[model samples]
Target: MAKLPTARIDKLLSSMGYGSRREMAALAKAGGIKLDGQALADVSDRIALNPDLPQRMRVAGKALDPLQGLVLMLNKPLGMTCSHKEEGALVYEVLPERWRRRDPMISTIGRLDKQTSGLLLMTDDGALLHRVISPKMHVTKSYLATLDRDLRGDEGAMFASGEMMLEGETKPLEPAVLEVISERQARLTVTEGRYHQVRRMFAAVGNHVTALHRESMGRLHLPEGLDPGQTKLLDADEIALIFA
Candidate 1:
């Protein structure tokens, strides 16, 4: 059997956002780039991006064992927008250069406004993103809302009924869940990704939403102690949990 052709590590990873050639060279000089658990002495060396060949490439501490897929959950902070062309800082900026643009191109699974904060999902798998966030799938997104006053008038029943006529919608919602935690705090869960749905839902019932924080999407909850502006790659199980 013949060996596969190799790709320049710097070319492949730099295109994936590892860094500039000089920056990668610096990392190589500092002994940060590795191949198959061995420190690579040269950043420009060509190697097969083959996961099956037992030659993994690592930058900093992240191992790009398989160069085809990536999924990350970020604890998005307040005031930073989510977009490829937004005017301000982007959530994806927290990730390493390699995680930014590659063959498949990374993108957010869904989106959170600059004000909302919590578990934000990013991935290079287009099908997975669609499977999880598509309205037809009915995946539930949970939110912790701080309101101006107590929920009144059978709000829970109304949410469960899905008959509230929100503005610009031709019909009612697909039913939602609302649980009061206190006079001013509540947990709301909904399946649709309607623009400002949670805030508007409370407003429809005559309450004002003051603070909105997403808590979960599907079975994937933002892990405890994962602070704002921090991010971590999803473990295999954690990735599965998003669809579980």
Candidate 2:
């Protein structure tokens, strides 16, 4: 039997959603791509896709596609790290014993600092992760924050006026929705996710965030009645909202 014709290196990498044509070409030039039984010689080089090829393809010695992709949301409890650090409690630790046993190798779409909690998503779909995290997508994330003090009248205007500075940056934040929920709590909705942003923003205006909880991402709200450390699989529409 005749072997199938080879696919161009750039085409294969692009189909895998590694990058755009130009970017994939650069990666190929940097020796970042491989084909069955040989390193890709050029971005335009044609390489056959062997149906019998082993699942463990190498790119910079990193394993590819060892586990199926999974998308789920967890109500992350404080004190769990988002990373897979060996020394500390990672977010996966809070999953039911069955999920850990499956060893699906999921990762968070974005991180919630160890001190903040709620509406965290874990998945292995790199394409969707990239889309949602990319600034171009402009996905909105909402949070309910409990502060140490109340904002007096007209203080909420600062959110729209860009008076808040998140940590590790000198520039003010993009416009956001800030509404008082109570004397010591408020709802904040923003399109950008910066490090400790909620806390820093409150601090910039003479208030302190005592507790923070994310309520939604895009159109998907945290599952009703979900308690801390619990998780559930996301439905199709909910998944669509992440990219919407």
Model number with the top TM-score: 1
TM-scores of all models?
A: 0.80, 0.67
> Which residue pairs come into collision in candidate 1?
16-98, 17-97, 17-98
**Candidate 2 structure quality by residue, lDDT tens digits, 25-99:** 776667665545455657787766664332435554443322234578999998888887756778988765434
The predictions' CA RMSDs to the true structure, in order, are 4.3, 11.0
**lDDT score, residue 75, model 2?**
93
Q: List per-prediction Cα lDDT, in the order shown.
A: 0.82, 0.74
Question: What's the residue-level lDDT of 61 in candidate 2?
Answer: 47
Which candidate has the top score in lDDT?
Answer: 1
**Candidate 1 local lDDT, 1-244, one digit each (tens):** 7786777777776767667778878888888987778898776788875645324656787766345556888899988788988888898788766566566778888889888888899888898889988887888899999999887859999999968889778889989998889988999999998888999999988999888899998899998898998987776788887667
